[model samples]
Target: MTIILAHRGSAGTHPENTMESFVAAEQFGADGIELDVHLTLDGDIAVIHDTTVDRTTDGNGRVTDFTMEELKKFKANYHYKHFFKKTARIPSLKEVFEWMKGNNLICNIELKNNELPYEGLEEKVISLIKEYKYEKRIVISSFNHYSLVYIVNNWPEIETAPLYSDLLYKPWEYANSLNSKGIHPKLKSVSDTIIKTTMENGISVRPYTVNKERDIKRLLQINCSAIITDFPEKAVKLKRK
Candidate 1:
């Protein structure tokens, strides 16, 4: 069966990377949630996608320039003001972890450090997973394969996946080389052949941003390990039916 992972917590229906969105994903019966994490000025793990808050929040600056206290000031729901009545704020990784204690959703935590080079990000995320005892429920992923490699070397108990947008010649072999349990590739890069071949070699293939009904049905029909989508509600319905 294919598991549905809400991309940034039902981003199509709610604010991306906010607590409200995450809660909604769980309510919609998604098997898991996928989110991104960036380091704040005070070294806290802030769970927003972009390097800057300008796009997602009312604030105009880099996420790394603000302390967690400062980052909390900006409403993280700038994009969906018309759709939702309540205000949403950026959530820390700790806060999200605390919320996870109330449920059993597998979390795919993507490290947003490929561009900025956030020092100690891997350590910080791994430490929190250990602190919360969420080792079995977490999957650490990154576009920066080096970070994934570091996690594989230092924290083999936790699972790590390589996130790529481009086509790799043989991703399964690459994943094996990095000791990764899965590969999270762009939706276009995934074909039925890729899904079958990759999983046959003992590696899971999870595509990102898969929201189309046709695509969702196809992946589910083929028994994809999981799909990260903006609309978990729709995907869940299709999977169940």
Candidate 2:
């Protein structure tokens, strides 16, 4: 079956990356939840997709500029009235892990690029994964090849996937060099030849942000391991049809 990965936790219907969204994804029968992580000023991991809180939340300034305690004051989305009729706050990574403890769902954790160099961020993430004993269920991904390579080299037991964009330099070679288990290309950047070559090289290809039924079917026809989508319900229906 084509795995339905809920991009930022059924983001189309719920607030992205909040506990509510994650739980909603579970209720909606999504196979996995994909969320982004950024380290706060106080050495805490915050579950957010961007470097700043201005766009997604009611707060301003960069995520790295605030302490976790301060970040708790900000809401995850200002437009979540349709789902819960109330505001939701950003969730911590540990809180998310606790929520996923017994659920039969995988967690796709994307480590967002760093704004300031932090020592041992990768180690910290790996430690948390070990602490949760989620080695089998968690997949770490990053657009930063350095971070991805660091995880690949130091934590070989953990699966890693590199997020590729149109600007990637020799994308295949980079993925191959890092020994990534999978390659997550932007939906538009993916092609039949790329998928075929990636598979031939023993690397799985899973495209991101694909919501349309025709695109989902096309990717499946190319043997994509998964399709990360905002509307997982629609993707699931498409898969069934």
Candidate 3:
């Protein structure tokens, strides 16, 4: 069965990357939750998708510009009205990891590269995973090769997936170079030929942002290892039949 990974923790329902979203996805029976991490100016790791707070939050500057205390003041965007009354604010990576320790859900942590480059971020993340003993349940992904390489070299035990977009061709080669366990590509960017080629090379292929039933069926027909979507409940229901 294609794993149903909740993109940004059921982002279609709650504030992406918030504890509320994570819990909601788990309750919805999502196989795993995907989230992004950015390093703050004070060197603290926070869970946020964008480099700036303009889109997803009430704040008006780059995430690096605010300390953890300052970021807490900003209100997160509440994409779903029926589920949550007021949106929750941004959460720290440490807080998320602690939440993971008690929950049964798996986590896919994507390191956002736009902010200050997060020197030694891979090591720091690995340390936290080990501290929590979640090395087996956690998978690290990144668009930056350096970050992926850092994880592969320092924490080979943890699964690593390299995220790629259509702008690049033969993205599988890049994942292979880093000895990644899987390749994560945008669903629209992957073709049947690309899927066959990637699987033939012994690398698992998982696509992102796949929400439509037709697209989900086509990806499953081609035997995608996983399909990430904002509506994981829809994907899970479709896959069941």
Best by TM-score: 1
Cα distance off (Å), candidate 3, residue 180: 0.6
Query: Candidate 2's error at 179, in angstroms?
Result: 1.2
**Candidate 1 regions with alpha-carbon error over 4 angstroms:** none
lDDT of 2 at 229: 92
Q: Which 10 consecutive positions of candidate 1 have the poorest summed lDDT?
A: 76-85
The lDDT ranking, best first, is: 1, 2, 3
Best by lDDT: 1
Q: Candidate 1 clashing pairs?
A: none
Q: What is the Å distance of residue 118 in model 3 from its true position?
A: 2.0
lDDT of 2 by residue, 1-241 (tens): 5788999998988889898888888888889999998889999999988888988888899998999889989988775655566688888899999988769898999988745555667887889999999999988888787888888888899999998777454456767889888888898887778777777777777789998878988876766788899888888777777
lDDT of 3 by residue, 7-42 (tens): 999888788888888887888888899999887878
- What overall lDDT goes with each candidate model? 0.94, 0.84, 0.82
TM-score of each: 0.99, 0.93, 0.92
